[model samples]
Target: MPAAVVDAALIVAAVLDAMLMAEADRPYAVVSTTVAALALAVRRRLPYLVFALTLPATAVSSAVVAGAVALYTVAANTRNRRTLAVCAVIYSVSCAATVGNHDLPAPTRVDLLVSVGYNIATAAAAMFLGQLVQARRDLQQRLAEIHQVREHEQQLVAQTVLAQERAQLAREMHDVVSHQVSLITIQAGALQVNTNDPDARTTAQTIRDLSVRTLDELRHMVTVLRASGTAPTELTPQPTLAGLSQMIANSGIETRLDGDLPTDVSAAAQRAIYRTVQEALTNIRKHAPGATATIRVRHDGDTIEVVITNTPATRPTVPLPGAQHGLIGLRERAELLGGTLTAGPTSGDGYRVQLRFPATTQ
Candidate 1:
């Protein structure tokens, strides 16, 4: 109901309680009864305040009901131990005042005790029921909060698992397919130079042969990575740092490499570095075709750095389409080895990628 309507209803109830108190032979009935009735207006919001206001006026029978309502309100809305203790004291006082006011004979005193006991018991039951309801509400709210937190944690876990799986797949593709395709490209180039028939002579023949071999190796890698239908070791050879130079050469891009690389680098780090170099070259082939590229690897005191750069092409560069997680995966791998990777367009408009990996001292 609207505020005006609720206030009008409260005014009517207070007038009725005042009139009822006037019929009794109580002293200061109107003033005391009006105050107790007015307290009911804010009983639920301020339960203990209502109990304090109504307890003094509870000498009158009409005000006794108001005190009981206030006690019920406190039990329903609050779980404070002090509030409960105060209500218990008020209830005992009200019960004593009610029994003392009644002028009964000795035999009826037993009846009065039974009636007062039942009334106190009934009031206690209401307070207990309200407290039970409040406890249930609090438990439900906590459960909802816990469930929401669990769902948020589950979403984070799922995203992390998906990211790790993508990185692992990228690593496998670079390891198995890149090296095999590079070998096929080199063998095809040698054949092109030795073959003499114009009909049989095709520059595209080298790319086609390499792509076929790459597909076969990719299928085998997929089977191994699945692990459910096949053993991981049954797949083809796992490449090491030795295959990186050939990978850079196979994409029909001119390249230069310098410095002796550590062959003993961990297999995981080696695969990550090879993939980084291959991705850089593939980006060059797609974005800066016909541009000469250089990949330089250097071993510092406790770090290994790989830098790949290419000259700007005559045409504008277009980004390649894929998962777009290649560079992100490379960065993650570098970070796992306590290193870093950077990729961006150079000042001369060519693309450049640089990566650093920390070496294990042992």
Candidate 2:
């Protein structure tokens, strides 16, 4: 029960019982009873003193409500069994002797024994009730501590699982992507050696050099992932809007990017825009050979939008094996950030990829 209700109930019970059973005809009796009952108001702060104050009422009349309540409070707040035992005995004695002290006829032996036993039992009952309340409080505190430990264990388990998953991703990047880039480097080297045209040889040498650089960067990324750190080690700077022009230049695609993005755009949003454009350029390289591309990034009210359009292939394109996972991953990322991504064939037999997400900072 709530503390306020318990206190109110105790005070009300003591006051009503004292008024009903205390000797009202005698002024001293009335005063003692009233004081004893009121003393319970401070029982929690001064348990022994309150119980002592209640003794006069318990000794003179059958209204032992205040003494009993005060004894109960003492038991609940204290753990000293010896002190509690003495208090219990004193309260029992006071209740038993009340009958003889009130100018009644002297009681016989059996009646006296029964009266003493009953008062002893009452004192024991109050003490036991208080002890029960204390035990319940202790149990609740223990359960709360156990709950906190379980939460900590759950967090540790989650981190362990994340580390395992990151290790798996690093393995795939090294095994699959690294092998392909190495083959590209070798093929470019062969082309550079066998070709007679100076222009073709120069192009092959550029391809070989770019492939080697990409492989080295990929290895650096894989090493960082394999270490399983919470924050990635910055082996190289993360790509941002500032690097977009250079990225497009290195992609070997004839593409034009127009429109301005705010300098204060959020880092995650800028990275998303960079990756989306990079993925679009990769698709065009494989599926739309000789296609000229245009990219436009704009801020429309609260929206940050980017659109990539590529003309249809100008020459016969090789059928490259693809599962379109890049676009699927981009769509999932957009959804995670409360955004949308759409891609389809344009009116001029071209392809278009558009992304829209809530504008950040800017």
Identify the candidate with maximal TM-score. Answer: 2
Q: Per-model C-alpha lDDT, please?
A: 0.66, 0.78
Evaluate residue 323 in candidate 2 and report its C-alpha lDDT on the 0 to 100 scale. Answer: 44
Candidate 2, superposed: residue stretches over 4 Å from native = 229-362
Tens digits of per-residue lDDT for model 2, 1-362: 97678777888898899889887787776887889888887888899999999998898888878888988998998899899899999999889868686666788899899999889998999899988988998999999999999999999878877776666566445434654565566557667878999999999999888887887788677767767734221122446888888778876679998898656677767767876887788777667867899999898768888999999988666434444545764675566557999999999999999999888532
The residue pairs that clash in candidate 1, if any, are: none
TM-score of 1: 0.48
Total colliding residue pairs, candidate 1? 0
lDDT of 2: 0.78
Query: Model 1 over residues 1-362: C-alpha lDDT tens digits?
Result: 78557645754665575676443666665666678778788776787788787766665453455666667778878778677866766675665565454455543767768856766774687588768878988999999999999999999877666655544664556544554554454445445656796545586474656565564556455445433221111123555688876666566778888777787788767866777877787666556755888888898768888999999985443332333445765776677777899999889988889998787722
